[model samples]
Target: MLYAAINAKDHAVYTLSTVHSWRISLSISPPSPLPPSQMTQEQYILASQPNPLQRTGCAQAYPVGIYGWRKRCLYFFILLLLVTMIVNLALTIWILKVMNFTVDGMGNLRVTKEGIRLEGVSEFLLPLYVKEIQSRRDSPLIMQSDRNVTVNARNNIGQLTGQLTVGSEMVEAQCQRFEVRSSDGERVLFSADEQEISIGTEKLKVTGNEGVVFEHSVETSHVRAEPFQDLKLESPTRTLTLEAPKGVEVSAGVGEFKASCRKDLTLESTEGDIFLNANTIRLGNLPHGTTDPLLAPGTTYAKQTVYEVCVCPSGKLYLSPAESASTCQTTNSVCLWS
Candidate 1:
């Protein structure tokens, strides 16, 4: 029985050893250090991670990765700022273009690619020539002056801006409000009321007030007043002076006429006619129309010259004969041969 037991124990021990050997043979072996190609998925992933320069999107969970993320954020912010700046600049340029579209320094007035445009003004005054005046709609320019108002519609559009009142006796151009426009050395003037306006190519003059008058003539381009009155005139030739009495006579030949004083006036001309109108008349020297030694009241009766003179209704006068010193005191005194 003891030997059997011993044999059984030995048998069991052998069986256990054989089973252990079998299990050992079936078990998986511990893996060797990975080779370059045989590395695990985790190891491969770690190795394939990009370098700092090549990295994109999120970095790995490391201090270096955190620094890279901050740098990326900074770059993104800078890019965003650049985009915003570009957008703002575009908007500003657009706004400025829109604001200055209608007006321009070169075209002081309204102008288009097709032609120039002039707005109708109530009044205007100009000292230069007008090269061109383009008007829109049916607005007119009312001009008043003592000088002649010239309308040069040679190449004008006939836009009929307004009418011109020249050499007006009522309103004066000197103290009036007016507007003017000029381009390329050309000027245009406009006014609303009557005015003593002088308009010509070279010069322009205006006269105001009751005694204000203008004289335009082709023969003797002269302007004169009786006394105590303002006269403005422009002519192509010389100036002439004539004197007359209030109730005597008044005359005009041609051209424009103006009177400032009143006196018995007699106007007679051999070649041309005379112009006489209502005006103030001052008792002045008879012949020369100026204060002179010979024209005093108590002077001797020297000689009679042909000149139109003004005498009061019953004023006393001494007429002397040219041959001798004989004086006559008759109303109808004439050299009679009796």
Candidate 2:
């Protein structure tokens, strides 16, 4: 029984020592040098476990040192900034080269060239104000507008060597009156609502319309009418006088003619014969039935000397040389000689 008891005590001590040594070995044992392919599942799991002696913090928790998610974002931002700055510097250099500007010793920037060329369409939003706009080249400066354009000036003068043409459906000038004057001021074409056309010291010509009319008296050196048709003269209640150096001749188509002169009527021709012809003849104040001897064409006679004629009661006529006639046997009437 004593020996058995001693053996049991030794077994307990050995088992305890074995357990303590195993724990100590486990605590201080180095990891296996073998690769994952050669290591056992349990050894691999042991090697993969986190080291307790290693430092652990917010920064150290990530696989890459000092390069966490936040740090990556900051790095990308800085990289983008650097790239943008480099691009801006390059564009600035290009612009400066294109502009051709130079800096002088006085630190003033100046244009080194004369011309400036723009690539694309350029627009100016503000008004293009200028004191004067002039074209230096021979090409004309043209301004075009889709709608109406007006120019207003207090005084405007235009001298054109070439012809001026105005084309439109209608053109009008409006004012109280208008006048066109010659250089010497002697000739003018004046027009107004109240005043008629007055042409001074110049010939007035009107065409392509109705004939002219004289509202008042017209005194001219001569008057001429050249018409394609007939010429007419009208005097309603006035006298018309036509005086010419030569004689007057009137010719017309076959028509009746009648002329009446008031008071005394005289028919005289300086170098022409007088002709009187008709179907019948009448003399003095006698009617057509009178049988007097004077009505006979060859009965009336006249002597060159003065004479007096006497008419008797029997209708017999006798003549005497004296103013008184008493030679008739019957009572006689004295007649005066003509």
**Residue-pair clashes per candidate:** 38, 0
lDDT of 2 by residue, 193-299 (tens): 44555555445454534556554555454343444444445454564454455655444445434544455445677798867676864333211121133333333
What is the C-alpha lDDT profile of model 1 across 59-93, one tens digit per residue?
A: 22222123468879988999999999999999988
Which lDDT values do the candidates have, in the order given?
A: 0.42, 0.44
In model 2, the runs with Cα more than 4 Å from the true position are 1-66, 86-127, 150-338
User: Which portions of model 1 miss their true places by more than 4 Å?
Assistant: 1-73, 79-83, 86-90, 93-113, 116-131, 141-338
Write down the RMSD of candidate 1 (Cα, Å): 22.5
lDDT of 2 at 290: 16
- State residue 86's C-alpha deviation in candidate 2, in Å: 4.5
